[model samples]
Target: MADATADLAGASPAKLTTADGRPLKSALARAQAKARRRAFLLVLPLLLFIVLTFILPIGQMLHRSIFNDGFAANMPQLTQWFVDNPVGTEPDESAYAALAADLKSAAEAKTIGVVGTRVNYEMSGTRSLFTSTGRKAKNFEPPYMQAVLEADDKWADPQLWGTMRQVSDAYTANFFLAAVDLARDTEGKIVQAPEDRRVYVMLFERTFLIAGLITFLCLLLGFPIAHLLATLPLRYSNLLMILVLLPFWTSLLVRTTSWIVLLQGQGVVNNTLVATGILTDDTRIQMIYNQMGTIIAMTHILLPFMILPLYSVMRPIPPSYVRAARSLGASSWTAFRRIYLPQTLPGIGAGALLVFILGVGYYITPALVGGASGQLISNLIAFHMQDSLNWSLAAAIAAVLLAAVLVLYWLYDRLIGIDNLKLG
Candidate 1:
């Protein structure tokens, strides 16, 4: 029995040891190793998913932005016209012949429009250059070149030639510039979009403005609710918390649609206002089809994100902090501001960041409620991708959107770091 007992002791769970068996790892090290493994396992799925869905698509789109060569690839015979130049500043006669041949062939093949449109995506006048030249050129030689020069003194413009030289690739920054409401002139100078078409810049400004407003509303409204949740009795707090979460249980589309029905001209809100005599029967407030509707709907959808984070941070703060401040002869507002408000900064930052980021990319709420002026950048992006069939333009806009979001995130991170230092 003693031998068996000794054997069982030897077989019992042994202390984990290093190779030398000198107490292999500290508790922290063991825990860290377990955490590292768990973290890697937990993140692997998300990493793979993002790579497949986001990273790959973004990379593909960016690649397309600079690629511009469907025509050149299909027609190598026209290349002799472009390259036959004598390697001097003046474009040689052979170069002109090559141009005429290429244009004639391109026009005959019914693919002149593709090249023209692609070039026009960068320089608006390019379509005129190609289209007018093709139609007037009875031959690919002097007459066509003369027509091009006569049609626009821009033919004398070497910069337009430079743009033509660059179109052999399938990608160009033209779409990106156009996405931001800028365009390249014949001289290749980037300038503001024409006065008649300055809508894109306004759209970008509106998107940011709406996002900021929604974030502000979220923080202002959510802070008090979160404070109540953190301070109240656990039962009551939990009930309110459940209510905050209840919206998430319903489909997002359903909620947005409901808001539409509730806020529209003849909807519940307008009817109530009219019945209350605040609004005359014929005087309808335009709430549902404007920025107000978007803000209200988005705020409702995103309030939980703000509340939960603020509540989490506030709950850990003990009531004794406020009591201690009060005992020191601080006023009620002073105690709350000095002792309570500072502790909640982290949650405030987290919740604001969450809501702001979500708001920037909002599409459905804005689309359903936003009339022409209320539409955000995302709506235009969708229109370019689906309605306009302009994938390059859509991709360019998406790239800008991603860049803007990253800049905001970086600023948020910097501010959060500073806040932590102040708190510490």
Candidate 2:
């Protein structure tokens, strides 16, 4: 009994060992960790590439939306004065004195124009005020507030003071507010911008409306084509696929130009209609250089994006399912609605998201085809960046657009799941 007890104790759950006498569990864990490290190392270059090329630029743009140092950096004394004072506090002699000194310094440095330009973005017509004031600030003597007001009564405007206070901080939400067509009043209360200046919100709404329309159009047109392709034999489908891919091989400019040629009044379609008595020469359709032109051009360009995804998802679905439903006494329409439609949802989600995202940022097609009435938010972003030279406002607009897209993506992930987003 004593011997048997000792034997059982010795045999009780001996530590696992590998063939080479290393502990098997520990060895397996080490092997797994090494494999993971190797895999990460292999992907390290790709990760770095994405960070540098994509992530860093987006991060920089988002940062620019809230941060501007044009006034704060250039007008240090005045900025400090404003920071020391509470909002709505009437600027006293000391604040005016500080402003005079800063303006003098900025004028000497030839940077007053930059500061003025920054201020003008928030308060129109203030560019000349800063530049003209700075040019004469050198000759101004004591009783600076009275002297400054004498130079320009505009200096005493509470609105200008409020604008200055708002921009005193190196970081502010003013650009974001401006992006959404909101502003801070003299009392520091948020308010809607004046009617004439309230354009950005409308532009954003139009942008989304256009994108949604394009997405709907793509789905409406793409679904039937994809279904046909999937149902057809491989030999015929491959031939049809070439037609779909043909547009992709063509230059985007060329495609847009082609649409212009086809849709313009003097173009082939209208001329043909005129010759065929469908419409008189005076009654040729007004298509190009309008919303209709934008829609048609974008739909053609983005159709392939929709078709490819739907085709990939549909090609795998067996005909047997539909046949089985039919055998079970289900009507053709009922079988498609219940079984086929549900199965294609993943593809629809992927295609719609891809098309919508692309459409929202569409610049070239809209810029060329979309006239003033048809212009989108991207056109305004470009206008600010190049024409208006309001880069900070442009950056702010881009950041807002990016935030909106991310929110939509997050909602999509929560509802449909990112794992379900499949692409060929």
lDDT of each: 0.77, 0.92
The list of candidate 1 runs beyond 4 A from truth reads 1-45, 70-113, 123-166, 169-171, 418-424
Cα lDDT of model 1 by residue, 246-323, tens digit: 998999999999999999989999999999999987898888878899999999999998888899888989999999
* Every model's TM-score: 0.78, 0.92
Note the residue pairs that clash in candidate 2: none
Relative to the true structure, candidate 2 reaches a TM of 0.92
lDDT tens digits by residue: candidate 2, 329-418: 999999999989888988999999999999999999999988887799999999998998887889999989988899989999999998
Ten residues in sequence with the least summed lDDT for candidate 1? 79-88
Please give the TM-score that candidate 1 achieves against the real structure.
Answer: 0.78
